[model samples]
Target: MFQRPGKNEYLESQERYVSLVPAEGDLLTILKEQTAEMHSLLGGLTEEQGNYRYAPEKWSIKGVIGHLTDNDRIMSYRMLCFARGEQAPLPGYDENDYAAAGEFDRFTLKEMVEHYGIVRQSTLALMASFKEDAWTGRENSMTRK
Candidate 1:
């Protein structure tokens, strides 16, 4: 099992997120559990509810899922590169821009939820393939300008 990341592993701004998980928690199990929880929660929403944005500028349910899916894909790709010892810098992304361009509003809520589940599974599979060293031996290779 991988040890929880040190404070230096991630940015200071991300401490809140990192702290939410217990140091002893099993990362793979937690991720698997969350996938089922999110699928059930999001899959049960009605079409109208999925399209309802609370504010003029906020993302709707589908948009949020799309953003999450995109985020997972990017994160997993970075993990893949780093685990393999890549040295290139990774690029930053704008979530709002990605959400807007995704046009998730066009797909049914169920589709978006399913897609999210698939992406989550892909991430899990990639992580599972890594040996313990891949999780702890590599210095963080990800960087943004």
Candidate 2:
């Protein structure tokens, strides 16, 4: 079941984004519903459309989707570390670098969406295995300049 995270549960820098999360339902419930909604939203884009960028130097649609996948992986890893009570500081990743290296424009939009779905399923499973203590787990906040 979802318990809204307390003010101290996450770092202040992330408050804006974390605050956007739904506070009324379990994590899995939100994940499941959002995943379905995301799939529906992006499912119709074709490879040609995915390659379209709104402006020069901007990320293509596929690149944007790929970055979302990368974010999911990175955040999930952080959650796993916190859940397992890992005391070591976790380093951050550059989403732009990951997106560039992913070469998402090489694939069809369908492939990118499919990849997200699979990763999300794995995330759901990992989250489902958490114990109550794990659910409430916290980690030391490490900041980078």
Candidate 3:
């Protein structure tokens, strides 16, 4: 059986788990800045670098970017669920499985980066529109709990 965390446990866990929960006044700005940074880091890679894996069995840079895109989408969905007060436990994903299936080694770094930028922009727009109440809301996300 699953048990809800006690108040102290919840608070303690939240301190370590929540990511990018902006201050009351700077939510939009923070989201914009973060999105821009993601764009900048992802935009400077070349095709060879994207396909180059650090290890034979590890993900290529393009795969890493794809994984980040997937994570952003998942977090956006979780935020939406939290904002609407959903109690259903969201499912977790296998990162390695997803990365393996992505076959990002075939794509050029420039293409992957462009795709990441578009996804990040959409995520930023969604986050920027959330009201204060929504931004501060909590949910039992797989990533956080």
Clashes of each: 0, 0, 0
Top of the candidates by lDDT: 1
User: Which lDDT tens digits does candidate 2 get at residues 1-145?
Assistant: 3866767666687789778888778879898999999999888766788889999878999899899898888878887887787777788788788888999888889989999999999888888988877775444232212
Residue-wise lDDT of candidate 3 within 52-139, one digit each (tens)? 7889888888888889888878878876776677777777788888777777667778777777778778877887677766644344
| Local distance difference test scores for all models | 0.85, 0.81, 0.68
Which has the greatest TM-score? Answer: 1
Error of 2 at 106 (Å): 1.0
* Candidate 2 weakest ten by summed lDDT: 136-145
Native-referenced Cα lDDT, model 3: 0.68
Q: Where does candidate 2 stray beyond 4 Å?
A: 138-145
